[model samples]
Target: MGKKKASSHKFLALAAAAAIAVPAVSPAAVSAKEHSFKDVPARYTEAVAYLTNNGITKGLSPSQFGTNVSISRVDAAIQLAAALGIDPQGTYKNAGFKDVPKRGQWAVNALAEKGIISGKAAGLFGAYDAITRNETARLISLAYKLTIDETVKKTPFTDVNAQWAKYVDALVKSGVTEGKTSSRFGADDHLQRGEWALFLYRLAHPAAKELDLTIMHTNDTHAHIENAARKVTAIKEVRKAKPNNVLLDAGDVFSGTLYFNEYLGQADLNFMNLVGYDAMTFGNHEFDLGTKPLANFIAKAKFPFVSANVNFTSDENIKGLVTGGIAAAPKDGSVYDAIIKEVDGEKVGIFGLTTAETVDISSPGAGVMFEDYLEKSKKTVASLEKQGVNKIIALTHIGFKDGGGDNDVTLAKEVEGIDIIVGGHSHDLLKEPVLDTTGKEPTVIVQANEYNKYLGTLDVKFDKNGKVIGHAGKLIEIDAKGEDGTYILEDDPEAAEILATEYKPAIDAKKKTVVGKTAVALNGERADVRTKETNLGNLITDGMLEKAKTINKEAVIAVQNGGGIRASINEGDITLDEVLTVMPFGNALAIMNLTGAEIRAALENSVKEVPGQFGGFLQVSGLKFTYDSSKPVGERVKTVEVKKENGYVPLVDTESYVVATNTFTAKGGDGYSTFGKAYEEGRVSEPGFVDWEMFRDYIQANPNAAPELENRITDINQP
Candidate 1:
């Protein structure tokens, strides 16, 4: 990527002295029913009327408008910059404010270059300081290059102290201070919203026109469908009030509750469809059930799933699921690409990507692979460019930079030719877009907070060449106030009747039945299990081992994949519903006999694909071993031991021991092919006992008790 030449049109400061004469109010100013400025001061009548006509300024109070309020330096800059027709995007050189953010300092510098107003000191801009009425008028006059008559003398003011003598004369000549009844200039007063509108209108357009483009968006949805519906309603109302509109999602649209888990993303897809989501991409949790389920979701979705680097071809299951017509093998690279659309006559290209950590921390069956995002993004952009896509958008499941190991920042810094990056995954809320330093192309990145609590809105403008001209974005909270519940499924009589007639009884029954109780919370999150032992996995495998022992006392080991334990048990009266959520899949327990050598081989094979990356290797009851990755494959297991009722016993190399695990791993999942080899000749038996039922019994017998997660599992020999 090559840097473009710097923009040469330096911003100039507004005039330090107020200038220009007030004009007569036109009929157009007061014709619109929405523009009522009865409380405006007499001196600002023309400016107020002009602003009201343009739809920029509306009085804050019906009877008493605060015209003497001071304006913050940043607010003043925003107003004056909009008046001057400058692009309010990109980074500017720092104006030497010790507290101003690096990103924020750009706006300050841009205001300074335009000579809107000088800072308190050289290289220092006190952005937080207030702007007085006279100061604002002068800045506005300078920004508009307005000139007042020099022959006019200072107007009479009872409180025109010595300090503002020169400014008073200039303001009087410009007719900006004619309504002032006293000598006081109200220098410390905060500027009101109405005052800002009047000032900007007078400075920019004596006769303003309504602005085009109204954008609405949401972020960090996390599958909270009901609240998302409310946000959509609010956005629609705003859209009805505006001329042009676009709706967008920042990301994190799936994976956070029983609804997502139970239906495997069907609920989220249905809700997003109701909200009319223009586009979305994967969040980290979107991979919770792995590639196959994710592809199933994409198949059902109407909107485009965008990502650049997530390659689905590496996993055969994912390839079959994402492709609509046929089941393809893992080698087909076409499944994991991007979607292009033409919205409102603008050629838009969207791509998606998730964090690389998802490969290890998510579900075991996510056979897809993640490549270097920047490299893959470049390829995607080039391909889109070849397809005549000039406006590119990245729907990223990456997250905001929290000074942590964030890949989104890396993507922003390395990737170029992107117009906007709608990001999620970290759950950080960004009210406005962050300009990346990738190139002069101006990439705007934004994200909303987690859950369906807020909606992000962005209004962007483009030139004839499809280059971004301007944009404004904000986050709107979805509180109950003015929430009409139009988007709610409960509001629909038919839907409510269906729920009452069909699903309500089943839901009530599931909730009422007590399954068991737990003294402590069980582990369910991927981070908890992939990197460490979990009580839930322990209890589950313990049940399997116990069941196997009943059939054969020789059973010495039990292992289950951490991914199978979907939910944690909090301290409470456990219900059947909770148990079902935890162990949703009805996987039968299987027992098999394997020698100590074969057991060690199975463990080695579990860690082979990505060493120390097996969440499925979690075991309970009998089994203890230290694995060193630096050693050769067959020699990695050291000090292999089995648990007896009394204590630990050394594993005999030739002695046959019964092992128990779920059918998934027994048949070979997570590359545990060594277990498959052992099962080929060993006797296998399926116990009729339901795994969840046994788990409930175990928890009931040991109330408030959780399995002890000792650091018995160790990793070694990493080169």
Candidate 2:
């Protein structure tokens, strides 16, 4: 437990100035109900003595302390902040709560800023809610950074659960006042004024030094080297503000733009080296080029790669570079596993875990094996704890679990002792770190928006026992609206030069090469394609269908997960670079034979998270479907029809259909297990073409592909 600094001099100074010892009226000074309570001043003698002695609370009148009356949570917050000598009369803005007044906002913000009291959902402080003993105790313990010394005996609370027991124990062991009951804590009872006074007073008495940790991170950067200069500038500013800090990259620093296409991730390596990344993990995209190119990228990368779960023992090209380290991966000359980093005399244990789904989605090759995520996380944390390192940060590529995959939140719940998770792959823009409510200590998980668009900074504070007490963070925007050249960062001259003289000319040349023309603009925005059908979705899926038809005579359908489409094509001439931007993953074509039942199941999967955009949301061609999104998942599809030579007809469940899609989805990339099963059943084949090339070719073949919302897929319930 961390000791707290006491500001008792304020109380002593007040006493000296007043020239008074205790409050003027002692227990014997006046009769109850007469001068104090107006009902029972004599009934609360000791409670009065404790409050006055600690200088925590003053009675309403000169002789009366409102011992029996309930206290509002907000009022309690103000009192506690005051007891800590933090005046909040008018310092903070809104206090991040809607109901709090500007005048009283600072106190609430102070407590919240320290991670003492978390508001109700939607950032509500519940100012007026009556706080029970258990709730109040938890907040107090958090604010004071109190930990139960295992050696100290328990407080024996009858009401609080095992989860709340340790906190209640800390409250009592602090020698703050004993609970309302000797053996049983009245956990559900409303906190009264006198009890509140005793609690705050005790919390303010301990004295100790504070520990601060600053973690700067990035995720899902996807090879945007131009924005790297700005990212470097942001880090320099952060280093100035916090001398003691760790810089980290959360992976996916590969793929997306021509930078990766031409340099094959080496361009990213040059910029990352200039930025001085402490460590990095292999996002699934890192394996897109199979192992040899990945091995080349790893050999040139200056930073260590960490991931305990991904075992790369098979690919001969990288195996020598990885399995036994050989100066290729993390830990100086070791392969890949957990690494211990020493920053400012603190032993910070770091580990990494990519989602196990990487095997099916990317070309990690048959050699690289991904272990179970939760299992690996648990083992790594235990290993760290055994090393006497309490502070642990998991640099993970396993994103926030929005789709049906193992994610940061699930990892937080299942793993113990992880203080922070710097995650990627989901491309979530977390304004603040997400804390794990289930863990013993706070486990913070954070991810910045993808494509080098935002640089995330997380400031964490740790107590004596190395438990995370509080954290604050924000995602810095990568560039100005609609412009890439203009960024918020002054370039690191070396990184800027690498982008300019080395990579820029090639990318610029390719960008100006016109490939095709479109009559109308494409809607490839995340919200549009992921949640609903768009003209761009129709066009891309048609490209896949046209390409698949050339290989297989029976290929009639093309399916593309909205996630595969990255950018919108404007009306007019479309450049090859623009096509690459629209389909950046370098995903290759795969032809699969799936039964209509499996196809319908895939449709059901697409609409499962309706009203919420899931990357797995299907955008298709040669098929039409109607779904009632308001209905429950698995039962949402109301009707499905397949286009035949004569007309569109109902899909036959028993009959198999020839379908084409990117290799990612064909192998069950984004929660599409139905397609994965078909792939595993030997019904899938690679058609020897990349997604962007195929798209360009199809666009060239058809001068003006339809860019209209044809209502191919719609919600039947919508009017």
Candidate 3:
């Protein structure tokens, strides 16, 4: 919790040369009633009446409050004195000012004697002159004894001078004011009567104590439900400790393990619902299977989703769930640009942003359009502010410092009013909160890595003005183990039952169902597949080629990046689980048009780190290549050949050949810049056949398929 500075001070006046002290009288609590002043704006009505009822002001005539009129120095002193519970009629010695007026003579003289006021000149009090904002700040600070932090060297306001910086800082720190804008104090500007009344009312009634909020967040869970029970326990523990907490997920709950393949996202959604997520944003992977599955998932969700930039208008499936603009009363199983929730009597605003890269990286279909993240974020913040919500959060799936395209770090630096960023996409495990003080107010960014490994917890304290004054964060290891290799935290029984009885049986059965039979062990081991030609790599690429040809018969050659092949297949029966494990990312096959020279450049990149493990190591089908490791990196490929109907022919530099590869590599996953260029040039077409399904079909069609290297990728330097 942020320690609040002392804002309440008694108006103590000494005897003799000093003004007489007055005992404070507690004013009666005012009922909720509208005042007769027609000119007072609704925001300041209560404050204006509170001062009026306390005998501070009778108003200009009966109906007019003169809310915007510049308050003069004498009038300001009288009001400040009466609002401080001082008797303005008390007798006091003359203040020794020649031009002192008779109307507020006693109040001004009493305040001057108390050392709270000083004359504008040696003999002139400037009693009739309009008091400046700087004067108001100093008077309020002294009268209320607002705690001033002397160590603060500078404030957000650049215009405040050395003489009055502390006073202005005191008022801001005490939540009395945030200035006219973030950077401008308007210190020399004249004070309005209504503004001073509001300030005095705040001093009289300090805001409902500073709010301390705790947020438990997760992101990129990606169907890793094995430890979902333990994650539930961790979340429960946090909620037990901090009841004033909210649970949020930053997105990507769709793909990764066999659970998704068998149940789509239902299994993950059950656990998410059980754990009670307050809101979630869509990650790129959420659109992997297109709109129908996503629509079904949202329909069954217990909480709403926030996506400020994703427009679901054209899509009929999920468009009805969307309610654009800020939602004051958000509904469950729906989508909104932003939502406001009252947390512990304080209103907090939350909005979401999905990456624009989703169009190329995932299958959102044509109807689901993604807007520019940065531009949408600015409008979202402004909209939230207009709703009178000062405490705001951005739950985002944009990566953290992911180049410059779209990420959390860039969002924090560019946007001004966002208080906290619960981020994902890059799967960054920020052990501590990253504070961006570059903006007017601080923005705290946190991410809990990926795959349900950790549950991130952030505790933040906001002042009355909704400025983040203090924050602390950490990632709780969901599957933390004891010394004996036993789990440290007990699984939540309900969650465990849901997983064991509800989903695990089908998953186990699916794991055992044989997809195909292989005579020998497919060598997809990390070291072999990444460094040398493996039969598993050859099989995968051949499957990719076969699948690509079914959609586009022009595809002649196929290449699979070694990194996309995750596991080895044992000899004999190949179960469905084995296929999923080997190609777990669910990368779709894409065919790209490439010139022979461009193919040669891609080949050069494929073996650039030859003799060492390169994930981009090309696994070939319908092609052969010879390279000498003794040669330089770019010039390693000695010769390339393309398979014709009869046999292999030397590759023609100027000729174009249709090539097939997983979307990851075709989109430049492992520095395949040549292939990436082809993809960027719109020469690539996605048949959308998932890698594992293609491999499974290819093996099923030829049950006894056992691929062996035919010296397809020969290293001339090898013995």
Q: Residue 79 deviation, candidate 3, in Å?
A: 31
**Could you tell which candidate, 2 or 3, scores higher by lDDT?**
3
After superposing candidate 2, which stretches have Cα over 4 Å from the reference? Answer: 1-210, 323-334, 402-404, 480-487, 512-537, 543-575, 578-622, 625-719
TM, every model: 0.43, 0.53, 0.60
lDDT of model 2 at position 30: 38
lDDT of 2 by residue, 1-719 (tens): 22122121211110101111222222444333344454225434544554444343455664556677787777677666655445444354445688765434677887777677778877788888878888887877776555655553345766767767777888777666577778778878899876675565444323223358788888777677776776777788888999778888777776666777778888888777777778887787788778877788778777677778888877777777663211111343234666666555445677888877576556788888988887777777665554345678899987575332577877788777788999887666689888876755678999986777787888888765667778898887766543565544677676667678888999888788887898889889999899888999998888888878876768888889999888898888999878877887667677888899999999999989988999999899999999998998899998889888887899999999999888778778898898878755656654324678778878899887666887889998777
Q: Which stretches of candidate 1 lie over 4 Å from their true place?
A: 1-216, 238-253, 314-317, 320-336, 364-366, 402-406, 482-516, 519-572, 576-719
Residues 583-644, model 1: lDDT tens digits: 76545456666777777777776555335445565555577677776787666667777888
Which residue pairs collide, candidate 2?
4-206, 33-38, 33-39, 325-334, 325-335
Candidate ranking (lDDT, best to worst): 3, 2, 1
lDDT score at residue 165, model 1, on the 0-100 scale: 45
* Candidate 3 structure lDDT: 0.81
The best candidate by lDDT is: 3
Against the reference, the lDDT scores of all candidates come to 0.57, 0.72, 0.81
Q: Give the TM-score of candidate 2.
A: 0.53
